[model samples]
Target: MSIEKHDASVPHTGVGSDLAEEPIGNPGLPAHTWRPTDVDDGAAKRAERQVAAMFVGAMVCSVLFVVVYFTAEIGDNQDVFLGLGASNLGLGLTLGGALLLIGVGVIQWARKLMADHELVEMRHPAKSSEEDVATTVAALSAGAEESGIGRRPLIRNTMIGALGMLGLPAVVALRDLGPTPGDALYSTIWSEGMRVARDVLGTPIKVSDMEIGDLINGQPMAIFEVDEEGEPLVEGVELYVAKSKASVVLVRMEPDEITPGEGRENWSVDGILCYSKICTHVGCPISLYEQQTHHLLCPCHQSTFDLADSARVVFGPAARALPQLPLAVDDEGYLIAQSDFTEPVGPSFWERG
Candidate 1:
């Protein structure tokens, strides 16, 4: 704790200079006191062992976190403890313990085993001289020597092991991101004969229900169908996934104003056309429409699509046209899908080809 104060009257130019200007006199550091571990060989050994134990505990906790991740069930049948899922509880406790033990181990090592000497540096020019750089390097070397990293193999090895083992939790957790979508992104629940219905109300839409200059948010009728027991056929995450891909916008315009793509002459019913609601740029739902221009706009990035002519990207960052769902009329006159989308819907991906 002994501090050497700089003389204010003299200017400091480089390292080893005891000269620097200060606004006031220095309040020197208190007298130095040696720690118990520094004075006693037995205490030093005990402290070293304690730090190594904590690092070893961190390593164990880290391993346990990975084990729990693989063994614990995540859904309905998952084990619960104190109102929390066993999977989550085990993960939190093990990961938290690993971090806590490592932190405590570092604190103990610094406080008890590492050098406890105090240092004081006076203000000097921003740029250091060659001599100052050399001195700094020497000081760093001395610090490494005093830290006992080279001399104490137990603490060093345990610390390295703990740090290395901590990466296991992160590596194993990446499994949760998959299994890859595969062909799921290429299709939806809009197979042939699936009726088109209003999005939230789930009411079937007929060609007569839509007038010229009208735009309606719609989804496949399969989601609204219920079982004989009066329970929803599609519910929960399944319903959400189906709605995300099957969602569409039905627009009605003057048939003469429409310009059908080659081989898509009968894709629309009269003047009414159906296209996926998802934007081609980034899978954002698009509803903003200009009935006068027969253009659909995605609010997310101002991507404009010409619904009058195959829903092609007319503006903004969208790279492709909106996927069209061919329309057909059922026996009851309700709008039904001629078939699933001819192409994949939503944002473009590497496997989209």
Candidate 2:
């Protein structure tokens, strides 16, 4: 499309010239260009087949996504491709190709097959009258008819099949939500005699290692334990899952400053106390400590718990106190857990009675 230029030297002497002078002549709509598919029946048929082929390709990709999701190994036994996991690479390419093909096919259908008439919509008030609403409905019906969806069985059927195939991936993904958590959320790797070790380095912590107002991010020693072969007892995804649930924060304060809850008189050793690092509100690791107040703040939601008072929720959105792990001195003077947490850790769930 090209715009026609107007000469400013010419004086406006037309019917509306007395009211206002025209700075530039209004350029009307350009001549409509006809596509080969619009004029030739053979070209239109070929375009229809090309669109159907794309929809078929989309269906194939969607099917491949489901196949890769089930057959591809994940976690420790995962296969590698170009320095990335094969499962991830395959799933991404297949799903992405499926979406891309569908989008391209829709664009091609509109450009080559749909009604090519150039229309100009006049500006109107925001409010639509009843007659305008009826016209809009009629226009939509006309558009559907012009698109030839009812006449093109191949394109319509293949497109529907491609869209239906997309749902298979979603259905397959639902499996990840389960093997139902069962009693897993109610307990963690923590058990009798599991020593409290510092995070990352995993070195066991002794009472002497902590000072007044000191806070240590710790985890269960089992994560660091090695087998007779010198390999980690827990590795890969298993290690991650264990660490997330069994993580703890050790805090030390004045012995008199501590207020033990009912049945938790012996839960702490000396002035040192241990609580689940996971926030009670959402499960974000809570390590932001205010030593003077003995409060543990969750950075994610600002849920604060008073470590000096049975890890009680003193402020913010936490609905319950942080779960305390019963502490005991091992034969080697390292801090050890007396048992698993008396209650479930992390955010409360529906079945948590």
Candidate 3:
């Protein structure tokens, strides 16, 4: 068949006609500019030094943390800071600076030294041809080569070693968590004649000092008193541990309101009685009280105990009653421990024997 020509005045809608009308050709890519660190030897060297300095700072901070842990006394009035303990301040600052330095170092290395390139990839259908898969694998291998991870054995090994060493501090610190409590929870420093004192402040309590319906959180006088030499009485980790376990609540009820437990007839002096402040439910300190009902409540888990009935668990999830510390009056009329608690304090644990 012979082809017929269209009129010149007509608009064209043919395939070759569309190609001719389309945007002329590919615009092609913009020129690439290399970073100073990539082109200049001096800039690369400077960036490398800056990154090394940050890592060195991190190492120094880590060392300082270990030093502070040993040198700083944990709870001496001597180590007081701006109302915070100096020991805590030093530990927090050193450890935090170490982590911050590592983070900053990584950011600087990436920004000032590492390669920077912008890429444009064409979107395609989800399925790929076998050739595309091969190309992808080759690209990944090329990227690894460009990253220099295999070539730079020193940096690779150093990074691995540093990260591995970080685990050592954690393991070493676990030593502080335990040799286990042993029978410490079952007993305290509250021996016979040891005066009951305010927790932390350590002021001795007299029967006359407390008013009826009053509850004062207290600890043993041993925490504060010095030996004959005038040296610190309780000077180490043992002191803090003792103070924590020996905490008590001294409550004064009317003589008529007191009903002592069996074998606890003389535990109170003129209706002022003492009980272990540590809750039996989960070991939270208990002090919330209903003076009228003589009921003591643990704030955690709402474990209620009847203080009048020997601190029996009257309600809530408490598995056992609060432990009562037997009390007596010393020669000076200060409230004293008749003995250490007859039962374990705080949450029940195995080996409390």
Candidate 4:
């Protein structure tokens, strides 16, 4: 529709019956309020200096972050603050300060030195003429002039320096992700005679201990083991690493109820069998068990496995069965792993087919 538009501020622009319309009173702007930096040249200079100081501070923090990343030790017994490790604490604070100061500096520059006058834009036809395009380019140029970036050499130079230094920490952090985990997932600490122990207490499970339908979470005893001199066999990160691969679930069912796969008919003890507790799809713990059907459910994505049938994936996203741990009874009648899993367990990756 090519109809004429009416405006209260410019009623003469309207024609025909639009003249009798009431004036849509101009809410003119909320009086030209001037900031201290806008009215006083001295205050403006101080604001510029303050913004520059913030940028300089950001650069300093970024440099300190790199220094701490190399110099600090992140050992188990390293210095602690309220409970956090000192290396982690220092790096976190410095990087956080670098980011925060840069943000605050940019905000101060915009609020204190950028154009403060308000211009009301009117509603009109969507298409713009060549004159309107020229007016927009001129307004942007005026905005750039009012922002004072060219005249404020100190703020402009320091801001550039601050932005340049921020990338240093990210490059330094890339080093931490290195040292690949080649062939580490192929085997765990579970050897032929290593006893299946209670997860934390290291209590060995005897063949007579569990009844049919009973399920117990277990791990290789070597993780909680003590040396001949009574020191821990594995501690800290090493202990966690071993536990991740050696974790398992022990379930007992009737021999008639089980369906052993291929040559693995003798992998279980009495009515009991053991499988990795870690799920095949992304390594979530498989805890939800239905003893009746011998189905183990991974709570993460509902991947179900038929434990009786060699832990085969009966449903969901897992590409393979839960890896089974061959079991036996030591002469002492305690449950032990016959050997490490025949193949790698848990989630697969490009390097592991």
Candidate 5:
């Protein structure tokens, strides 16, 4: 509760001489202040109960969150509030409330029950001496004792319950990541009749639209198809997944520069060729094309593929060539996929077998 004024002539053990040479002498700490809970048993008990009550409420909310998760109907016809799904609304509120309660309880515990005394820690070398390590361990033990956690049974148990219950939501939500993608990567939303359209703008491309040495970033029309009101039929996560896997690039080089793969001789139309935009190395979209050399470059890892030679690996980290999409013209003269990619697209994985 008190500290004697230091004799500045004999410098403190760990302090440098420069610190002791300041014009203003050490002011020392102000008088020790005691909180009402620290001096009165009844007030201390009341504060402890209030903190415990908060933790208990957190535990209750966590439990109710689990109950609501299991009971709430999440179908298209399920309950709605203010245009938000009822199940999502309930889960968010309960989880948020529970976390808020635990935070408030911890603040109350520290402010009212934990040690209020202050002590100075001297600056030292980066490497801790053996004596300093022992002192640190002792200080931690003293801090734990001052927090009154051992003496307050109600606070200790409720705080433990609240923290323990908090983990359930995380455990339950891991199920939402869904089952591992199996054979899903082997295919995409690109069907045989699906037409290739420009990315974002969704304008269909034709052989006449592209000139020699031209390359256009494109996506399948299925991802951008609109309903009666012209709103995209595929949207949100489904649209994202479709776009990622079905993305393509249409490139036109001199017909003499093309080197078609075995059985893929007809995969191109005139000088125009279609290839998966996703790099084989790690699935980064490949757009950096050099028309002079007919090479496609992946920026992520500098993986390069030769577009002229069936997108073959030219001079980079990619193990294989980019997958080719067979191209054909619809009656409307728009380029369409003759068939889905013959091989799986994107970076190779263990499940690729």
Candidate 6:
């Protein structure tokens, strides 16, 4: 064995080096050890069966996943355990089991049956030669034999079945994306007379409580409602989804500094305006505010919107402006929604016009 070194002072950018060291002699290959599957027919057969079992299990799980997906009523079903919907639980478990079985099958195949060898290839040209190609094919054939893939039809069939089953979950999940909205993107939970409230807390905001240059994050009142007994009205995944869609940002500036859009003159009071916190580009939450410019920036894609000018897209990848939530004062003088958002919030979707 020999060590090779390069001089520090040399400008070695390309293949040629000013102070290149000599090459070291190659070390001989280590002794090869045969796996139990390779030497023992019984062990090989057992391993094949094990791999086959995993694949069979994976396929069964995939079928169960489909069954769960179709049978589970995801919305308004009201069956809850540990704060999780029963439908969601069933779907997740079946899908997870399917994936896990496939993974374990592959791991077992590689560990107990696949070819295990040690080979040394000399460093040659960057491109492969005719001999290299021929050798590669031969190596693959050898590997297949050593792995007992061709010999063990059961394992091969099972692995193939397991791998094929993986596609079912992906295809089924795609349906959850739903039919493209022709105009759903232009709407939101915001509606006339809806009050703006602190998310989860459901507490209304007073215009006087907000100071100049203040930025307050909020959501729709419906998202944070309670039962008649003050119990949380919505729980689990429904609450999560509602919270995500209804998020908003409230900013207070000088009343004279605002430039409200046409037909939106009364949307603000005392220089306080509210807009969707979600970004228009990829639906990232926008909260980084520049108090002086009244500009909001999305942390995800760096999309910037100028709030003073109808929340217009100022810079970055966002194709549209932030959706504005019209604001009004209730008899109590607290900020309330004059209406829900005029447009949908978050990433551009086909439903959004």
- Please, what is the whole-model Cα lDDT of each candidate in the order they appear? 0.91, 0.88, 0.75, 0.86, 0.86, 0.78
In order, what is each prediction's RMSD in angstroms? 4.5, 6.9, 11.8, 7.9, 7.0, 10.7
Q: What is candidate 1's lDDT per residue for 221-312, written digit by digit as tens?
A: 99999999999999998999999999999999999999999989999998999999999998999999998988899999999999999999
Give the candidate number with the greatest TM-score. Answer: 1
Q: Judged by lDDT relative to the true structure, which candidate is superior, 1 or 6? A: 1
The worst-scoring run of ten residues by lDDT in candidate 3 lies at: 1-10
Sort by lDDT, top down from the best: 1, 2, 4, 5, 6, 3
Of 1 and 4, which scores higher on lDDT? 1
User: Poorest 10 consecutive residues of model 1 by lDDT?
Assistant: 10-19
Q: Which pairs clash in model 3?
A: none
List, residue by residue over 86-189, the lDDT tens digit for candidate 4: 78999999999999999999999999888676543445568987977898798689778877889899999999999999999998998899666788889888
lDDT of 4: 0.86
The TM-score ranking, best first, is 1, 2, 5, 4, 6, 3
TM-scores, all models, native as reference: 0.81, 0.67, 0.51, 0.62, 0.63, 0.55
Residue 145 lDDT (model 4): 86
Q: Where does model 5 exceed 4 Å of error?
A: 1-51, 65-96, 107-132, 145-154, 168-186, 197-217, 221-241, 253-266, 269-272, 280-285, 298-302, 316-320, 328-335, 343-353
Winning model by lDDT: 1
Q: Answer with 1 or 6, whichever has the higher TM-score.
A: 1
List, residue by residue over 1-353, the lDDT tens digit for candidate 6.
11123343432222222325524332442345678987998997888788788789988888888887787666766567688887778878877887888788878888877766543343456799998899889967866677777777888888788779878988998988976555545666667877888765679889888999999899878777788898877678667767788899999999888988999999898899999888888778778999999999888878889998889998999898887888889898888888777767788765456
What is residue 141's positional error in candidate 1, in angstroms? 5.3
List residue ranges in candidate 2 displaced over 4 A. 1-54, 68-101, 111-113, 116-134, 150-154, 169-184, 199-203, 206-215, 252-258, 288-293, 299-301, 349-353
Prediction 3 global C-alpha lDDT: 0.75
Ten contiguous residues with the weakest lDDT in model 2? 10-19
Runs off by more than 4 Å, candidate 4 = 1-57, 72-118, 122-161, 170-186, 198-201, 206-214, 228-231, 235-241, 254-258, 262-266, 269-271, 282-284, 299-301, 329-333, 342-344, 348-352
Poorest lDDT segment (10 consecutive residues) of candidate 4: 11-20
TM-score of candidate 2 relative to the true fold: 0.67
